[model samples]
Target: MIIYQSGLITLDYDPATDILFINWPDVQDFLVPEIRQALLILVDHIKSYDIKNLLIDSSRASLDIPGTEYKEVIKEFGHNLMQTRLEKMARILTPNSTRENKVEEARQELRFPIPLRTFTDSKEAYSWLKGTLAEPA
Candidate 1:
């Protein structure tokens, strides 16, 4: 079942399926410091949960962080797990091609070890990540 910690974030813990759903908060604008704090908090939360497979739903979120600042924070949090075990990191992006392109560009810039992809439809994205015939919960 999914448990919303607050408006800022929510944790979808499906122990039966062994999948952790992480919903990034909807931030109209990006603030570097706030992003950093969020990342740190996220890392801790994930560790606490001991999740192996993570499905990140970033459809409602926007990342407007400066490259340098983002890099520093990501680097600080970078380790084996950030790259590993995060089997499928997918983003459901807005319709704007340019904005979508920007998100893809940022993903490339981050250079995370895990495979990252973006989709316009959340259901399709989830299906792709969860596989063609995953038994529904």
Candidate 2:
């Protein structure tokens, strides 16, 4: 079921898998503040629904912010996410994009607080969230 829908994002919950799926709007079309607001809304649903697994499909998104500013915002989001009930998160990135490697690197680095991973395939992400895919060793 869709829990929230806005110009910046759309959130759907799958009770069967206990996962929340987020479809982020194209980052080139919106400012960071707008995206941040949508993310805050997502956190609210995550807390309210006790979401354990999250899948973010950002295959069409890309940030245009400076490196320093991007890092700052990511840090803030990380702090907020650590306070949630999330155990794992899978993000689907644009395949073959220039930023894919960078995003994957960030994913690996941020895997401490939660088991976060990046994928270029949505089916892979969904399978991982549904516990059908074997966890990496």
Candidate 3:
């Protein structure tokens, strides 16, 4: 069910899978503070529901926040997630090398305890999240 909907993002929860799905808005550029605010909302749901998985469909959005600001957002989000039951997160992204690289960099900087993966295909992303595909060794 959709728990939150805004111009910048939409959040849905799947009780059976204990996963939270986030649909981010299509934007060429976005503000870091606004993204952080949205992430905080997500944190609330994660904590409230004891969500263990997250699937973020970002194929329609391209975050244009500065590198440092982006890192800060990731760091803050990671810290918040650490307090929850989050065990894995999968992101669906458009096929852009720059964006992919930035995502990887952000993931590394966040250093989240949970496993995180990015995919170009929604099916593949869900498969990984559902444990249908084996995790990388």
Candidate 4:
């Protein structure tokens, strides 16, 4: 079921798998503020629902956040996530795309590990989050 949605974000939940799928179809060339707003709302939903698993699909969306600001979004998002009950999170990014590199860089800049990863394949991500598949070795 869709918990919250707007022009920039769409959030869907699968109760059976206990997974929250956060879609960014409207994130094309979007900025930090827009993404930050969406993240805040997303985290709230997680807190309110006691969400433990998450799949963030960004394969179709593109962000335009500049250098430091891009890291800002990731940092803030990661920081907020630490306060939640989330067990694991996977992100789906378009394979062989610049966005993939950017996201990885931002994640590394966090300077600490979190139960999050980026994937290019949705099915693999879903399976991993569902505990039916293991993280790629």
Candidate 5:
């Protein structure tokens, strides 16, 4: 019973939580054209929604595959910040990485205009996005 709406792409909108779950199912490797289109779609969606915060659940996505420009995709979205009111963003990463400093790494790597955090749990992410805790500069 996911209430989904279509703009340039498909999105599951949770009005109760003000959460938008983007489903870019066609975002696989070897599809540069679609990837570019998806990025544009994402930008348009954010602009339309005037979204200020997001919890991007990319854990289910395999972006590390060959021919997939993960960084490029991220950069495109990250760079589109000025036009959108996006203030906070968080990603749910898999537990595979030995790297323990993912939060800091994500903040630095993403190059967003506002705060970005990576979490192992979605609840933590939700809390953090709701400003339950003061952000550290």
Candidate 6:
């Protein structure tokens, strides 16, 4: 069920799967600081509900953060996630090579403690989260 809805993002939680899906607003761009704050709020929801899996659909929203700011944001997000019960996260992004590369760079920098993957398809993302995909070697 949808727990939060705003012009920037919409949050939905599925109790059966214990997954929280964060859907970004279409045609909206957010600065690093704004994104960071939003992320903290999202983390709070995960903590409150004890959510273990997260699906972030970023196909619509664009991040307007610079390279340095992006690094900081990812660092803070990774730190906050570490304190939660989140075990896995799947991010669905638009098929933009530059944006995808930037996200991968940030992921590598964060060295996130839990499993995190990116996909261009939401179906594939959710399937992986549901453990329908083969485990990585």
Candidate 4's residue-wise lDDT over 1-137, tens digit each? 99888888878999889999987674656666777888999999999999999998877665655646666677788888888889989988764365566667766776546577777898988888888886567
As for candidate 6, its clashing pairs are: none
Error of 3 at 7 (Å): 2.1
* Backbone-clash count (model 5): 0
Among residues 3 or more apart in sequence or in different chains, the pairs in candidate 1 whose N, CA or C atoms overlap within 3 Å are none
lDDT of each: 0.60, 0.78, 0.80, 0.79, 0.59, 0.80
Candidate 1 wrong stretches, greater than 4 Å: 2-4, 63-84, 96-99, 133-137
Tens-digit lDDT track of model 6 for 2-116: 9877666678999988889988654335555667778889989899988999998988766555656666676788789989989999999765566677667777777777999
lDDT of candidate 6 at residue 93, scale 0 to 100:
79
C-alpha TM-scores of all predictions: 0.64, 0.85, 0.85, 0.85, 0.68, 0.86
Worst 10 residues of 2 by lDDT: 98-107
Least well predicted 10-residue stretch by lDDT in candidate 5: 98-107
- C-alpha positional error of residue 4 in candidate 5 after TM-score superposition, expressed in Å: 5.6
Candidate 3 scores a C-alpha RMSD against the true structure in Å of 2.0
Tens digits of lDDT, candidate 5, 51-124: 67767665555443332245455556667654677777777874435222443443367655677787777888
Task: Tell me the TM-score of model 1.
Answer: 0.64
lDDT of 2: 0.78
- Per-residue lDDT of model 1, residues 70-124, tens digit only: 4455465554346444565556665445555554555566566766556677676
